[model samples]
Target: MPTKTTVPEDHRDDARPQFVLEALREHRHFVMCAHEKPDGDVLGSGFALGLALKAMGKTVHYFLDDEVPRNLRFLPDADKTQRTFEGIDPSALYVFMDMSDRARADDALAAVPRAQIINIDHHLGNKRFGRWNYVLEAEAATGILVLNLIGGLRQTVTEDIATCLLTAIISDTGCFLYSNATPSTLRVAATLQDLGADKDVITEQLYQTRSFSGQKILGRVLDDFVLTDDGICYSTVSQKLLESFGASHEDLEDVVGALRAVDHCEVAALLKESPDGSYRLSLRSRGRVNVMEAARALGGGGHFRAAGATLAGPLADALDRMLTAVRAEMEAERARG
Candidate 1:
């Protein structure tokens, strides 16, 4: 685990300055963005903030590089998300949620050069990549930060906003199962539930739900699971298997989570062959490994336990190299233990 450091506690009243609140009130237009290949937390945090801003009478535009996943389409106002960069006015106040660096901003990075960027994220590896950064590494999710920001508005959080925030919190904290789920996380989640978030509905749609093709692809991946020294387990999903199972990228979304559930697995790896010939690597560690550092070594970044990278090469070579690196890191961690 990464070393924990104490920062100022994030309270609703102390979270914002009077000047920042005045600046937000004066701003008429805002653009909210999330990282590339956004997960539930990124999407949920971005949309929740956008909705809160809109409720404050600010004209808000939500932007994403990739399409929102089908499961998250239930978020209110998701139809308003902008996927293209053309004709975007750079004058708007840019609010980036759950993104660590400008590179992960995808199409919206161009707008960052001219816009006043405010970054809100939970990743410890965040680069503070905004003109105004509000990073809380100890916070369980960016949605928690969004909730704090909304508290400054003094407006009641609606059901839609609550649902979005709930999804973000639940996903990022692995449904409150990950080690990062602090007492504050439960407090925030309980607050959202009181505000009308149906935890059962969110879990059913996000976790229990899976397409037939998705199930088949997951089965295939599990069948191919390989365990190495030090309890590192990995599986590779090739393009051929995807076609044979009538699965697309969406169908493989939960494969990494499934791999993480295997008993005795200290680390889980899922390598998917992208259509562009690059390999998409998702790494999950069970509290003993820092996958973010390993991912950075391969030119990618994310949280400690969950990080990913894309490698350009044959799938076999990429997987072999990643596993070797993981083995070295796990061995070092075991020695430390």
Candidate 2:
């Protein structure tokens, strides 16, 4: 059992965590959720919190709008996540993790009374919509917030909980490669490691283990890659291309990162065609651009270095809109300088 250590100085004065802790202590039932397209940070953070609540003997139900990504399915309790809140306890407190907006959790969550919702997030431009919003924008990941909450509640971080929280931090920080991985973030990760987080398993499953179909899709997307003269790298993965290679959207999860790795690439964008004729855009930046501002302008939101949006597609129109957003942000960055 891992005992609580010194509280991170940055969060020591924030009463939001204490407030959220009280609410969780008061509630007998909880329904945990995150954004629709589940990712490592959201799923791992949600599960860590849910697991802690369950260990306290409270009823916890996990809900998400989509299936867990293949790479993240190895996390404990990943299989138990439900797609709907059907048969949910009306009195259950709703807990939204790693997302700024409730709509990102599910369209149905919008109708739930705001007083019953707790929003825990670390994204920029968060709405703080929860009755108890623990929004620490400077923190590397929402998992860090959850870890603080667990420490505040004086609960031991069991091995499984440690692994889940570590996964959240790892995913959001791009395995500590992203600039967001601050010293405090690394400290939290070290604590989790000491608490027995399986770094080997996480590294193997998240990066090393790639499906054949996923590799094919990656190759195809790279074959069609484009690098604009202005250091904007991009590529498109159409639904037809996915089907031809027998791939799922999960296969392209890291494609944008690959694009972002190119030398001199200031911004990288990958647009994937959806079944509804929309394109899901994943944007990444190398510090020169504020991708979140562009994503927010396009009705999406994330950190400055990584953000996303969905645009209605004729393919050509969607591609144009995405590039326009990136260019605008780049120009804004230059003007700010």
Candidate 3:
């Protein structure tokens, strides 16, 4: 893929000037938000942007619909994030990072309807739901875009900002192992390191730290992994199983990836029981699958390799619908081959 300019296409019409810095300077009382069940990039990018804006003497609020994972608690200012939109004024400018669509922000999306929405994301399926959208399809992590936006403000990349950016880059790139990672991504990592991002601390806190309940849930999910079409693997955790383990949704975070790691598996599906009695479906794909399309068909969205959606029905019914879609896509790919 060819390298494209960082400037968004919508901004190209302006002959005089066009850049994120101009937009940032215009807005006050900013609210930074990320998607539900945020991973590293979502949390990291949001925090880094918030910190930078604060450094510039701008009032900023970071909002997330879900609780931050325990493992990511080490990120600077993680404790400062607001998980609810109770008292937030809708007049504040809303900047969404990592999430592709308004639905990903859940109830928080409605809290700031009239506010200027700036969509910053790397997901190919992004809906660009912002007054000023800066979607970078080639960037490995949304943090990279956050870094770019704060360009010339190199002095703003404080220890806190660097830590958050590093977390986002490492998590989104699978610790620099994913195909999306480029030489630029590595360079960004090095720069972040120089600014005081401790790789050992981040790795130890993120990958090495896991609750006992989380590990147990992962093991249980793996024990029941089922392979389909000799290439797809899947696992399901019922409400009963969760209750038996005294585990919440957070404990099952690693289950989907474990299923995807099975030998000969090109795709993995983890069907989890949500609190509302609906099924939350998470799908992961190897290089050969496009799980994002499958997730969108089910009224959810995410990246090509990792996507998710919710289904209001019995777990069995939802799993059947998901598998039917996956099987058809797999067959189509096979036919093309």
Candidate 4:
């Protein structure tokens, strides 16, 4: 395939991708990673790129200390992900995907030599803490950037690679329902399909199928949903509630997105209790609200419409803090108008 197939004209002048491409060719071994508790875009992008490198006879290690959500286990090479960077070559280059910083991959990866790191992400305000940073906030998913890199190498995207890339685009775009799904995203999706991506498989596994326990847990979250007067819809999912339903954090994967879809809701927040009693707050917004700003204020980061933060919980206090940050972002957006 041609290199220009995925690289848009505006991105051509950005030399970071070329620099990263050179690094990929120079390295004999690599360790690919994504954020802890990763979503599809992270897993898919890592798997696709890792597979491509493997095809070139390069050694690739995928480090993912966290569990792969049940739905995403179908991704190519999903079973190959390592729980630790055990046996990693001392000279292996670390490729961080979808995360703004290396710490998001967990405490261990935080200390890796920055000069040996290749940061590829689509998050706003990325720290650029790597030897080569290919951060493009305008892209809907990191996989798009990976595709461009693969195309630059004149790689033939196999069926598995196409499937993984398509999943990344579909997952990050809410199956193309989110505002971030631009014409370029759709065109890329179309190209992947022509390359033999199984869209039906992706749709069936991600959307059509849902565990009974997950559905029940989602029910519990929505039953006590709170919609604030200013159009912020919020909910809490306690670890106790999850235990009662025999579900894990993965069950709540799409719950926040569902909340954002509610009528009159400009923003949605889900405060979930962790095993250690801390809280992970997931925020989503319809176009006007910049949930990322709220998340950053609370010590997190992501795109403008979607972001998250961690809180020390006595659940109520955490909820209060998250609400306060979100309300402040809402006010800021209104003031901008």
lDDT of 1 by residue, 170-209 (tens): 8888789988888889988999999999899889888889
Residues 43-124 of candidate 2 have per-residue lDDT tens digits of 8988998899998999999887678888898899999888678868899989899887776777757787877888899877
Q: Please list the C-alpha lDDT of all candidates, in the order they appear.
A: 0.79, 0.86, 0.79, 0.88
lDDT of 3 by residue, 1-337 (tens): 1232454535523212134556676566788887777878888998888888888887887777677888888887888888666666666778888877777775756756533777788888677667677778888998998898776344478888889999999998878876788998999999999999888888887777887878888888888889976588998888888888888887776678888888899989999887778999999998787888788788887777888888877877898889877777677778889
- Best model number under lDDT: 4
Two-way lDDT contest, 1 vs 2, winner: 2
Residue 311 lDDT in candidate 4: 95
Measured over all alpha carbons after superposition, the RMSD of each candidate to the real structure, in angstroms, is 5.6, 4.4, 4.2, 3.9
**For candidate 4, lDDT tens digit of each residue in 148-189?**
999876788999999999999999998999888999899999
Lowest lDDT 10-mer window, candidate 3?
Answer: 9-18
The candidates, ranked best first by TM-score, are 4, 2, 3, 1
In model 2, residue pairs whose N, Cα or C atoms come closer than 3 Å (at least 3 residues apart or on different chains), thus clashing, are none
Clashing pairs in 3: none
Task: Go through the candidates in order and give the clash count of each.
Answer: 0, 0, 0, 0
The Cα RMSD of model 2 versus the native structure comes to 4.4
TM-score top scorer = 4
Q: Model 2: residues >4 Å from true position, as ranges?
A: 1-15
